[model samples]
Target: MELKEKLNILADSAKYDASCSSSGSMRKGEIGSAHISGICHSFSADGRCISLLKILLTNVCIFDCKYCLNRRSNNIKRAMFTPEEICTITLNFYKRNYIEGLFLSSGIIKSPDYTMEQIIKTVELLRYKYHFGGYIHAKAIPGANMYLLKKLGSLVDRMSANVELPTEDGLKLLAPDKSSDKVSKIMQYVKNSQNKNFVPAGQSTQMIIGASRETDLDIMQKAEDMYQNYKLKRVFYSAYIPVNQDKCLPSLITPPLKRENRLYETDWLLRYYGFKVSDLLDDDNPNLNILVDPKASWALKHLDEFPKEINKASYQDLLRVPGIGVKSAKRIIKSRQYFRLEFKDLKRMGVVLKRSKYFITCNGKFDLNKEFLKKEFIEANLVLGEKANSSSNIYQLELFHE
Candidate 1:
């Protein structure tokens, strides 16, 4: 098929792979600049605006991963882009200022090594032949040769190997060809190859949520293990979007978007806030409280920790208070050094007093209405508050073409 048609097909197929974070990269290309902070519009570190050409090299696959849209059993129009074609597309797009970088992934064709070679050739053409230094994020094919993985890592700024499912049983049932051990080994290889030029942005992986029977606690524990053991930069969560009818797949019409958002929030807590997996969940309560955020849920469960003195609280203590994020906590600390802060000052400093006022006291004075101070009332309010703040997007799915 022609390249534009292929682009649409492959890009749509690649949307399921959510490991496309662009943090931890800094480079001055011949055309544009890639900051160390990040390059993508979403999950950007330094708030720098940038776009990526997110597409797959090919939509043809040999493995019939039950949960995947590009599986071999799925009768979909297939497309593959030659390495030179990809380099040309990237350069032309970059020249037009359409995108700053590329996020390339692909399904296996011929063999793992051959498929990986095709991906690496695209990167090689972009970097050496075209002298394109824009940020590149490539996926390391699981079970591909270690040499190819290293070579690809050397060419791209960021590399990732997706651990698609959370549990081994899920892998066995849905995706038999993919093994957790292979994905883990590839991640270890990337972590060990953190030199000056090779994958300078570090590595990340993705986990498909709601596809299997794994609990939220189980997923969080696995993420914790990946962070500690692999030293991964990020663990992305993609809620299952069931497109094909299969006995192994869940019968869902819509994606578990709320679950995905809550997972992202919980992940932020684990990464930024000093929160453990156990702190957010227990043996009895496995799923996250979707009505309230993870931090707010924690605060409600441990009410004794509430009414923390804002003036006397440490920076860490301030972080524990609901609605006081990292920036607000730092602001509180910095502003407190100059003079005592009051409720108005907290609002000026960017604290979300609507949530924090219930958990904090300014100079030993509770400013909330005494009638709404009950735990049940506060919980109900938080739920309503979440619904009021939630927003949804509607995406029109393109008609299937062959």
Candidate 2:
């Protein structure tokens, strides 16, 4: 088949993999440079939009993952890109300023080792033969040979071995061919490897949300484990999109976009704001509140902790307050050293006072009247604010754009 035809087929097939962000990798060589920015119009840590040419090496698979569109039983057009073809496309796209890097994933071909070898060969061709040194994020085939995984890690900026479902039971029910242990082994390998160059951007994994019967607590606990044990760079949450009919899978018409957003917000809390999974969830409340963001939900429940005096609260205390993000919290700390802060100053410092006002007091003055401090009133207003900003609350990792 022609290269364009192959590209069209493989790229479309690769769309479901959401672990394609390309931040935290920086490499410069003769042909291209991988910046700290991400792919698919994603903003970097420093907030610059970038793009990548995301595609699959091949769509033919040995495993029949029920959630996957390219599962062996599915009737989809199959295409494979030779190592030379991939290098050609990546370099051409880089030279034309169309993309800053490549995000490559593939289905298991003959075996895990064979598929991994093919992917490694393609990356090797790009790095050594063409001197293309852009941000390449490759998927590590779970159960691939250890040597191949290490070799691929050295060549690419980032690598991921997706733990497709949240729990072992979910894996057994929906994707029996895959094992959570294999994915964990890959992460363990990346973590234990002594080589400084092994995946300089570190490793990340993707988990499909709302697929099986796992609660948000189950998913976040799993993510927290990956972060603590594997030292993973990211644990991407892709809301399940019903593509194939199966008795085992949820028969939802639309993806649970709100749940996905709440997960991301909760993830941010865990990573940056020093929140434990236990702090936000319990046996009674296993799932996140879909109405308000995780931080706001927590603030509403723990009203006794508020209204924290803004001027006297420590940096950690400031972060715990609703609507105060990392940047704004830091700003609050640095600015409070200069003068006594008030509500107007917080708004200027980028705090979402609509939510924070219910929980914080600026210099002994309540932003809202004490009568409005009731949990029901606060929850209602927060929910209304969330509905007003509903369009912007949904977060999905964009892998490609026209």
Candidate 3:
């Protein structure tokens, strides 16, 4: 087939993989440069937007993953790109400024090892033959040979081996061909590799939420384990978009985008805000509150800790407050050393006083009237604020038309 036809087929097939963000790789090359923060329409750590040409090497798979669009049983346009073609397209796109790098993945073309070899050959051509230095994020095929994994890691800036489902039961029920043990081994290999240059951006993985019956707590617990044990840089949550019909899968017409967003928010809290899964969930409440954010929900439940005096609270304490972020909390720490922080100072430092005022105090005085302190009132306001800030009008409109 022609290159354009192959690109169209494979690119469309690869859209379901959401673990393509690139970061922590910096190299100066003869033709292109990989910035520290780059992904498809994703911002880097320093806040620069970067784009990549995300595509699959081939859509022909040996495994029949029930949630995947390109399963072996599915009737779809199949295509494969030779190593030379991949190099040609990448260089041409880079030269034209159409993309900063490439995010490449593939299905089981022949075997895991064979697929890894093909991916390695394509990236080797770009790295050695063409001297393209742009950011490349590749998927690490589970059960591939260890040597091939190491070689691919050395060549790419970031790598991901998707865990697909949140739990082992979910894996067996929906995707029996995939082994959670193999995925864990891949993550462990990346973490334990002595070579500092192997996957300089570290490794990340994608998990499909809403595909199985796992609760939000189950997912967050799995993510926590990956972060603590594998030292993973990220665990991307892709809400399950049903592409195939199966008796085992949920028969939802729409993807659970809100649950995915809530998971992401909870993930940020676990990573940056020093929150434990136990702090936000329990046996009684195993899922995140869809109405308010995880942080706000947690704060609402623990109202006895509220009205915290901003001047006296620790940095960690400031972080627990509803509206203060890491940057704002640090500012509070630095600014309070010189003078007492009032509501105005908190606002200037980027605190969302609309939410914080209900839970915090400035010099032992609440910013708003005491009437706002009622639990019911605070919860209502938080819900309203979340609804106002949500960008769900498009989804709602589509639902209405349907």
What Cα-based lDDT does every candidate model obtain?
0.84, 0.86, 0.88
Kindly list the per-residue Cα lDDT of model 3 for residues 175-265, writing each as its tens digit.
8899999999999999998254788888999999888999998999999999999999999999898889999988987788878888999
* Residue 117 shift from truth in candidate 2, angstroms: 0.7
Q: Write the per-residue lDDT of candidate 2 for residues 235-300, one digit (tens) a residue.
A: 989889999999999897568766887899999999999999999998899988776788888888
Candidates 1 and 2 compared: the better one by TM-score is 2
TM-scores for all candidates: the values are 0.93, 0.93, 0.94
Q: What clash pairs does model 3 have?
A: none
| Candidate 1 residue-wise lDDT, 44-101, digit = tens | 4523234678889998999999999999999999999989888888888878777768
Pull out the clashing pairs in model 1: none
In model 1, how large is the Cα lDDT of residue 302?
Answer: 82
Q: Model 2, poorest ten-residue lDDT window?
A: 393-402
